[model samples]
Target chain A: MPPTSEPSTSDTAQPTDADALQAEVTRLRELVGPDEAAYTSLKIELWAARDSAFGAEMAAGELRGQVKVLEGQLAQANRNRRWMVERIKAPLRRVKAILR
Target chain B: MARYSILTPVYDPPEDVLRACLESVARQTFQDWEHCLVDDASTQPHVARVLEEYAAKDRRFKVKRRAANGGIIAASQDALELATGEFVCLLDHDDLLTKDALFEVDLIASTDPSLDYCYSDEDYLSPDGKFINPFHKPDWSPERFRSQMYTGHFSVARRDLVIEVGGFRTGYEGSQDYDLVLRVTEKARSVRHVAKILYHWRMMPESVAQNAEAKPWAYEAGRRAVQDHCDRTGRRATVVDGVVPGVYRVQREIEGEPLVSVVIPTRGSSARVWGVERCFIVEAVRSLVERARYTNIEIIVVMDAPAPAGVIEKLERLAGDRLKIVWYDKPFNFSEKVNLGAAHASGELMLVLNDDIEVETPDFIETMIGLIQEGDVAMVGAKLLFADGRLQHAGHLYNHDPFHAYFGYPANHLGESSVLACQRETSGVTAACALVKMSIWNEVGGLTPELAANFNDVDLSLKIRAKGYRILWTPYAVLYHFESMTRIPTVNLDELKVMRERWATPLKNDPYHNPNFEPLRDDWVLRSR
Candidate 1:
């Protein structure tokens, strides 16, 4: 019998070949069923976990991409700020001295 | 039949280095070996000359000159064709095998002829001619191997099995050996380990053996190798770049949402830890609720005295729907409290956490749960750190006195002067933060109620291990254990006696721990003979 198949409870305890085989199958099922159920659940959870991990990785990738783009923009702004500060400083000093 | 077919894929190694490697082979104690040296079209003419010389000098040394540079993997496959022996052993062109390396391997194989794979202990040889970083490895640990190829060299495998696993593939030059080891071991009936340091890995400036970062592509190849192993084995898992370079963090996903019974035993005592006044039970529960990303966890608080009146209301409020208070007013036995908690808990996996512990990682429960859910993994443990940022427990080592590995070691320290930082196999993990399969826990009769304070977890782990299951200590699953932080340490001399009497043999000598190492030390320092 298949490991996943449920036991046939309707079978009688008669001394027939099919009955004996079915009874043996039911006995084996009784032994392995609970463990099989737990294993099945564990497998299902594992798939979910993998999917979740993959999703997390994807989200992290997107965030990293965004951070990289932002970092570049920040660097450009810093460069522009430096240029403006240097260029405007002398003129501002000149204006301040005249005003004083 | 020739016992070993030593495959040495000679590339552009220096002349002196090549000579040393050849000399080491000639010095082997076990003589029945066919050394197949494949020259992978080195730019230097000396490389070919050295191989030709070696081949001419000894009939055991066979030469295979490649037409083009096929890299390490393809060259290894070509060398495999020339191999005519029972077993295949990989030896880097610049690396040296110890004198009795082959002898020890042959002895193990002769004893158990059906053993599919065997490896010996190895250490790196400094350029200044010093033997350093000796790796005293444990017996065949599949999980440890998956974490990182601790079994790096002196790998002796059944020749048929090597070819069956496709010898080796191209493009995995930097970590081709790791890839092959993974594949070959997957189908192996028995994998034995020789604990003696028998392989000398020479460290050169250019070799990946020297610095893993030298070939950054190697990490990606390693990741793929581990992934392929998981896929073939039908395990739901993924491998990612770890906190450090070269080491991999293998993340396994348990398929279903198996309910985790977060059983915490506490007396609800308040203590000022690092200038912050906190109740142990409240904070531990709060962290589990707020930090742990997983949803399927029931926080069962086994309290000694109904959480002092108003504290009970507050705890219930904090825990919300996930709290179940099991009152155990009996004279404080740590084991009984835990056993009572397990009885009350309605979950497949039992996660026993110390009341003083706070979750450091968001995925703490998930990581521990994933490990216990895996087949044949009886229990799971986490790396616990103290409040002052020192290691409280990083797994345990049984010796003359059972002690924690890296105990009192700096929390941020990466295993000072040894290889304790990697994920590894151990006899036991502390119940300070441990996860166990409830079924297995019951089968092992839970913790011995007699050991109320200490050694209960150790005894349980040893019993679980006896049932042919592994107890894993994961560095990935980390937590802050202000260990016995807000609780009293009731020294049970009788309980200690019970544990020592029961586990005298294992306590004296841990199979996972090497006898050569000093019994009382934290790191793998050699005990002077």
Candidate 2:
């Protein structure tokens, strides 16, 4: 009989210390697979979030432009509604003539 | 043996201004011209003296004094009779021609001998001799000409065409030149526009340039002349005075009540509009059915699959027989939905409308139909207003980029040159409420699906224009657009790149927009760059 736990000429077909270590490493990789996939997905979401923020900033800039235009239009409307000098002076001149 | 003959009808012009006018002609760089000046019995003594002096100095200045004071038309006819050149150029008594005016005209004429008519940009000369308000006119806008005499100054026409059009009519005294231009242009073989300020219009106290109300009869004459042009052109239209004095509106009569297919693409979205939460699609269909004056419209709603069933039922109840619902189970693409709705439509005309739109003008459909019926105009857009009654779109201006003319201006804001009050040709119009012929829509393959959300209408407009069809935008048709209420309109950078690549030339050079205008600006302000 050969030594039971020791390596012999036919020991290559048996599970040795190196083979067991390789099997343990394979099991650990299988355990971390789902978490690695989740991390990659989170990275992709981060990039999308950055893109959305940039889009929001651009939209905000356009809204600012719109606000400026609206303000200008308001000023123009006010000007249009204001009484002209000729119109005001005409009434004043008529009142002065009546007083005279 | 002169190449050009200038006609000037004098009537009590200030001596200094008249002399300056004559001197301006005399100082022309191109000397192959003769000035035919007719004095209509001026009460001022210096008028005759200045006329005689100009005539004596240069034989090109031929002066004639009338026995009695005939009006401007008669004086112009007399001056016309004295013309012995190939082309006759109209000049006012007080207005001065730029030094290179004749040279520019001759240069273009030399290139194109068949050029029957030519006009140029002009500016106003104040009483203090300061040049202000330069009119940088666009290239040969016949629709704009019908709205107003934009090509009033530096008008040059072939002598034979002028004579054939009967020179100037007696009845059109105040607006004789406008009448002549309309008649001449009707039969013109080719028309050219010189994009240079070749005339300085002297603004006297009584001049129409100084005060629009100074000549009230002129507006009436212009209206009549426009109506006459319409009648001659076999268009059943009426000309009416516009909101402004000089501009005229052509109210075209629609022939038959052609069925219009209103294609609206929506997600059955709702927003707090004017402090009321309302479903956009329901209100849009309701307004089309109930509020619009034109009732011969079929509403086709292309609703997304995720849309509420209640909105569909409401639209069905509201629109009754005029309603057609098409389910869109795909991703959101405005262009694709519009195409799908249009595919199911059975109408002569197709109106591409956004669901966030509400009909403001009762005759909005009728107005668009009338405009689309005009010459070669395949597309007509309504004046869209924001919810707060601010202008959203007047017309599209593609100056290196697409911009809405007078965007965010007040609803009543008469744009630079009363553009808002007039119906005219534009580079493009928004699809928010655009009416196009079904044939043209099919020809252009409808809105480009690649564009999806942004610039789809602009792409369609350019395609139609490329096929020699005109696109018109009228303030006559108005609607309120709750813009981007249903969706956030973020510009896709890819779509912009596609637009730049496809419509590079047209985007840079808009025929309706002047080159001197600022690029990327909605207002017609002069470019500082």
Candidate 3:
């Protein structure tokens, strides 16, 4: 209020980078409020979004590893099944008692 | 018209038993037969009544009741004294003769005019007159006859031969008939067999031969008879102890130390390789070279295919001068592989072994060879065990399954612990380990290649049995086996199918792969127990 400066054509045409950044920060602060609780909640929301993205990739990798282990177990099960069938197919002993 | 004198010694036999015996004699095809019934002062009235009735009905039947109650041997001799026929046949009052009994004897005497003595095969009947078993006799030979007397023979011999041998001896009471037969055969110009079923031996609970109870006296008499015959014939006969029936020992000097060729057929696989574990062949051969009790030994390794280069190199490094390799570039056929190996052996005895086994005892070869040298033993098998220390095979039971087949069981365990340990004579041993005389092997024609991988041992055992030789499974000889360790990764369906088919078909056809094994009937196992 001490001295009001007229707006320059360059400043009016496009906002400066530093001025834009500061304006966005002020807008966020106004929406959330200036209290410590609001500030802590805002920080937690940003951290949660980043953590969720990383957790999705890790979960997908773990699922792939489990799938590989399960496939190996299935192959082993089939081999054992075949071996059991073969053993059963062997002929049983024949016994003949002499007519005494 | 040749007259047949039937000498029957009667004790206090039941009326029914005596009637059956007389009826059987009456039914004989040869009508001109005379029966001498010597009664040993029967305490039972039924015996006299039956004998009197039979004597009155038939003119050919004669009765002689003893004044004193003499034993069976004296009564039998009394009957023999009354015999007036050219040929005499010994028959017990409790036993019976088949309808064609006399006809069979007449046929044999007429054909073999020079034959002075003859015997026939017999069948056993229960007291209730039910047929039990047929005791088939092999063709007659002097060596076979002297080695073992299988048939009681309801025999027909020239009267002079019986009299010259002093009929039946008193000392040989229970086995008097055996003693007399041995003496008659010795004195005879010719001895023969009818090879026909002409007699029915009734089995009574108290009968010496029929009863399973101990008859040490009878066995001793039989042993004496064998010894006396040998002494008379100037043949050195040593009673073979620790052997089963149908086995004998003959004294003969070793002509020369015969070289023994050991043949081992192997596939480089870990399962069938004879000495893969603890390097069996390598170690066994090394031991044989280092501590052999016998001087002459040769080791031959027959590979179905070239082993892995590493295995071959190791074997070559261990073989030294005693080992020979015969590469067989062919499919896996155990019998054929053995035959191929035998064809190349330069020894009198062939020792066959499996790849996955190792000889645990050093005296194994010597023990088997020594037994074979005693004569009569055709083949010897080592006791085989599994890696887990259970019996894999001791010997085989012939006709174990009624299908004329044999099987090995309880692999890698102690044989003496098996239920069949009581059976001393085995049908055959697993080809995995066996020592066989090359002479007998050649005479019997080695293993049947048609059997291929399975049951080849049974076929070989049967062939040896057919030659009147015994198959012995020695427990003293031991070997360790790792069974089926190198089996193919996949099951061979075709081989399996063929194995079963071959097993079933031969059993159906032969019904007795080993004639020594009595065919399975319901009563056999029960009676034995």
Candidate 4:
């Protein structure tokens, strides 16, 4: 009774700091829920986004590979066209037969 | 006793020549040889009497008279078909063989059991039986035989191979022997040349060389023979001029080291100092020096005026002792400058390089030199291309139609231009980057300074042809040429006038110059054009 004669402002501020800490703890508990279904749904959405991005990348790579193959085929066709014109078709039809 | 069936086709041969040939056959040391004489409907009574007498007297000799004249080639074929000996020998009724001809041939064949054919040297004789000159040949190596058939040795071949080739083509009479030899050599397991005089070739007045009228057909026959040989061997055969009487073989050897001299003639433009041209020279020289498999070379830079001090210093520092500067302060003449450079060359092969041109490959010199090393080739030209990789020159041809001129064509064509590009006997080459034999250059007296810058190469080529040497073009040897870089002002009025005058003189004066510019005339192009 002799030591606690007057009430101090520090005792009132100490309870307010405790109240703010309790509110932060309540918000953190809401973010990290104890329910398994909510956590699993969020994890599935993130995984789907990552999988879609990876699939898009793989499709682009396949398209590039196909373009290179087509270019090679086009070049070969041009060569064959020139060869047939100069060596085969023209020689057979236009030029006088060498046998004669 | 090994018997040789000698096939002789008679077509109104001179009485004295026929008798002499018959006497030679009668006097042969090898008595086992038989004669199969086919009379191809001779018009002369003396030929019939002589043939009848020989047939009646000797059982070894048989005469078959064709119902109608099928020509000399057909008669020879008929005689070849009738022959029943281990070896077949061909003899024209007008030519004589030595007494020991069969004996020597038999000895060579017997010694080498693998021998499919044997040939001996011959003496070219005049109609009066006077010796003109002896064509002594070297002993056979397959390489030498493939290089040139020097001995018109009147070869003795196996009968089966003769029959297999269908005897001989009728139209190839003048070169029937050549065609037969080429065919037999292709199939022959072994071939040997007896280095002795065993046959006599009669040089009659009516023969191809002596008679002006008979030459054209004879040349055509000779060309056909070359074509046939090329077909049979699966190798390209070019009909080049011969050092001797027969067709010169153009054989390519891929595996030998070549000695080369690179000649650069300069008048010292800014191009020589520092730029695209300088870079070209540096890169070409460096590539040749550093990367070439062929190590032996000498770089000759022929200068008309003194080069810039800076340029000289640069060349000295870069090349050190490998570069040799040949100074020519003479008049402005391209041919004279080249002659001056050639005079100082030490290599067995000489390359005339325009300083303006850059070599595309390190193997350019090697490829050009390889084509000419086949013994009979006098000169070779490389394929010239522009910086953009289009052809600048394949070879040269002369045109006399509108005016006397020289032209090159198929400027950017990728493949060969003509048969000449694949395998042909060309008229000449542009001297821009020509590879030639030093000996042949000396023999032909270099280039004429009068023609100088224009038609000088054509003049040199004509001289080579006159002496019976072939000028060749090789696609494998490639270079990039900024054409006529040294002739500055881009175009000179004085130079054009001079070139025209110079070209006209050679066109007028050269006797060997194709009258209709036939050298430049391509049959294929003519048909298309």
Candidate 5:
């Protein structure tokens, strides 16, 4: 509500280097704010991509373990083939013998 | 005038083959049947003589001759006119029926008095009379039937139903049986499958049993028959030739663009895929954003608390407004995370995907959306391939234990019945890349939390099936599943016990799989006997 005793700057003469330098700094700040934000966002995106690729690598390692388990199961199955065949064909052999 | 009438349209087959066919019918253990033979103006003189001898020998052998040369369809119609039995069994003139063929049919029909259609397994008979290549068929796969006529030989049907479908359409001469079966099943009250090899299709030089390509025109006829069936059944789909000759692909048309909620649960784990270290969730979202052809989808990522630093920022940057992040602070339970993500989704269809999956098919979402919209379908799963381009999951087989069908097979290898490439009903499909109807998901109570990781998808599948819903696996939608890359693949004893307790009967007897297949095997290999 009270009036100040300080004089207005617009009416003063303009020859100070500090004032020009300050004006230039204000202008540059306004111009570079969006570019800086964009650059930071792009960096985050790049990091995310790298993390995704790392996830895939981790997946490959896990796949190796799972594949090994499957190979073991397959080998066991092959080993039991003869036993299974004999067990399954016993009844058929009995029936054929009766018919003969 | 008989209990059963056997219809055989005779062409100029070899005299020995014709005599063998007649002898097989004459030696039937169930003797209350008549053989209706129609010679289609055979140019060879031996055909008539053989027919005359068979008719003279057995009073049950009814023979007729067409004055002009008519195709199989016309001959079959003439034979149909001569039938005066309650049921008709189709027999190729050169093929031989097992002695117990009619006996098995009679027994099955006696047990189920309301049976309208019946079929059995068959094999090819070599020139030296050795049986080989037995087609052990599933119980009653209606969807698989639409793909191909797996129930090819020894088809028995009620004579009234056969006559009602106008016998066989003239246009479908080569594939007349396929058309007839499709029409017959549409109105069938109960269809029974005799899981026995009752027919032996002779692999003659000109026979389809010798080589599928012997009659290429038959496949086109089959395609038209499928298309006509789709039209009659009010299915909005286009039938195209499948990877092989007799198989077909049904590309359904989506009614409207419905919103799809893709729920992915992850801990923001990192993996080395092709020597590149990357975040699994971020790459999964990136693939959806960059590769998918369908646009009406939202990405719901359920992330664990204390999330990896840059993963969330990257997902936001990639999916933008289409992304919704839900925090999971509890211990890692895949079922709970998926249920949490599903609870927050706002779409008609819920797509449960793993963090390591990369979309390979551009129209995978659209295809899944169309399939899940079917009235009887509860869920649909995608064909998954490993990082090395080997098959990871075609579907789940639960003959004894739950396992992936054709796991680690070549990516392009079609399974025993071309099942790996067709969209057909299955006992279960993996939740790694499955799209389910939102209402059906809620109805089945989602995945059972008790099954933290192992058998969760199998439990969900059984729950859905218990509600009389079908689970379909489609090869049309494909994805690269770098499985076990994030979470270690370990099975807990408690989870296995719970699954056994809940789904003991279905786990033991999977109707989608044939009994002749060896139990506890992923590949459809026959039993040792």
Candidate 6:
């Protein structure tokens, strides 16, 4: 709170290098503004990539489930076709035996 | 408080076996252990008397009796429930542990409290209590464990994980230990192997260890165990009985008919063989084409032309249309020759075979291809025998030395010893007759040309393993490898230095070789250090 004398002309002319450096840093900051928006957009891009991978994994799992079901159905259909062929042949063989 | 609870279930075990088992536990140097003896309603009065005597003598001994004849699984579960220790080890009543078994387990548990599971090396005990046939096991090898329960006996697990995996399954009685081990290892946070023979599995005539016929159910259960393991892990494989009893063969089916490229790098020279002047390449090619059952293979023979004159023409004549001869005009580099041959190879699978090798098994290609067909496995090697019929290359291992575990025993050696008798996971196998996936070969950038001779295969194996691929050694794929028949041996110190520098850590410590063992010997001897 003590009031000091104002800087003499000589003292003001020879400013400390640190003060000059700080002034240059502030001027550069003013020119470039802030990188906060760029970083936020970068975070958003990374999250989007993660979500895309997760969605692909889910889709692949669902497709595999559907394939497994289809395979089971095909196996059942093949078994039924074999059974029908055997059933048709069974009567035919019996009739032929009777004729003989 | 006790740190380890040993669960040993006794049925109608022989009195001597039961006494020996109990005596081993009683004589433990580590006092912080509880022997949880569960009697599965033994009809023999002596078994119960022995259990009661142990319980009365030692406060650390806990005994429980099943109402009916509950199998080993139920008895194990009952003993697990009775356990108050941090970790529990399963012991068979007929087996004996080394005096330091409990001490070793306690040491690891106390030192590294984070370890969830641990196993020790084991051997077999004859009926007369003579310890023999010690299995000096490797460190924690998940790939090897998947093929067979290499860490079967003296396996200790944290009590919480054991209880969480539901102690033991009901129907996997004969192979209850295998089932429990599979479950425990699946849920394990960390696994450790003591690398010392701390357990001795006794073999009685009626015991499953001695005779598979004693309980056919055990083999069936083992098959189911491996199949279930495959199912659980989603490793698409078909499990079947191996050539040996109590061992299972896991055959992985290939997607389609993949062409196999057989690259036999040789120097086309005529040498006197058993008083007959003949070219080895001619006969080797003939042997391969005539013997190998798999017909879908193309032979790529790389040879230096000027060294042997007309030998190339003779090889080409014998090889016929299937042969692709690459003239290796440059100085001899085994690694470069193989790489050059690989570049010319058209098959999906590349078999780096030596020209001196005579294919023994008709199903050599079929067997090796079946193994490498698994997506996880990168390569599979064969059991090679010398010209005189002694073993040459059972499986190649970097036992800190350039080589170890290659027993050139008698031609008619009993196929019982641990090393060559069964199919197992190995760190590296000699490229002499190794079948590797071409994609994997490309991935690891083929053999290191800088390592032209000595450790080219080892460097390639380490590189392949670095890519998270496993290598296997199978005895089923047998071949007679007349090792280095045409090639003159020379050691370049520069190449050796490159090898040592490239694999400094692995050279110092091989995962396939036990830490207790010295680098020069396959036999597990306590290292001086």
Clashes of each: 10, 0, 28, 0, 23, 0
Name the runs in model 4 displaced over 4 angstroms.
A1-100, B141-149, B209-213, B236-529
Give the candidate number with the greatest TM-score. 5
Q: Which of 2 and 6 is ahead in lDDT?
A: 2
Pairs that clash in candidate 4: none
Best by DockQ: 5
Q: DockQ scores for all the models shown?
A: 0.01, 0.02, 0.01, 0.01, 0.08, 0.00
DockQ for candidate 1: 0.01
- Which lDDT tens digits does candidate 6 get at residues B42-154? 99999999889989999898999988988888888899989999999989998888899988877787788689999998989987767766677877766556556678888
lDDT of 3 by residue, B306-418 (tens): 57656665666566666788889977788888988898898989888887765667677775675566467788787775543335566654343422111222332211112
Worst 10 residues of 5 chain B by lDDT: B482-491
Give the Cα lDDT of each candidate. Answer: 0.81, 0.87, 0.67, 0.66, 0.89, 0.78
The local distance difference test score of model 6 is 0.78
Task: Classify candidate 5 by CAPRI docking class.
Answer: incorrect
List per-model TM-scores for chain B. Answer: 0.95, 0.97, 0.65, 0.52, 0.97, 0.83
CAPRI grade, predicted model 4: incorrect
- TM-score on alpha carbons, each prediction: 0.81, 0.84, 0.57, 0.45, 0.86, 0.71
Clashing pairs in 1: A42-B255, A43-B255, A44-B255, A44-B256, A45-B254, A45-B255, A45-B256, A46-B253, A46-B254, A46-B255
Candidate 1 residue lDDT tens string, B1-529: 5779999888899999999999999999889998988999899999888888888989899998889997888888998989989999989988999999999998889999789999988889998999876777777878777777778888999999999999898767677888999999999998998889889999999766678678888878887898888888888888887766667877888788999999999999887554456788898888888888888999999998756655776778678889999888889899999999999988989899889988888898788777776688989898887765556788888876677876655554565222355666788999999999999999989999888777888889889988999998888777888764345666679978997788888787776667666676555555543
* lDDT ranking of the models: 5, 2, 1, 6, 3, 4
Model with the higher lDDT, candidate 2 or 3? 2
Query: By summed lDDT, which 10 consecutive residues of candidate 4 chain B come out lowest?
Result: B520-529
Q: Could you give the interface RMSD of candidate 2 in angstroms?
A: 12.8
| Model 3 TM-score on a 0 to 1 scale | 0.57
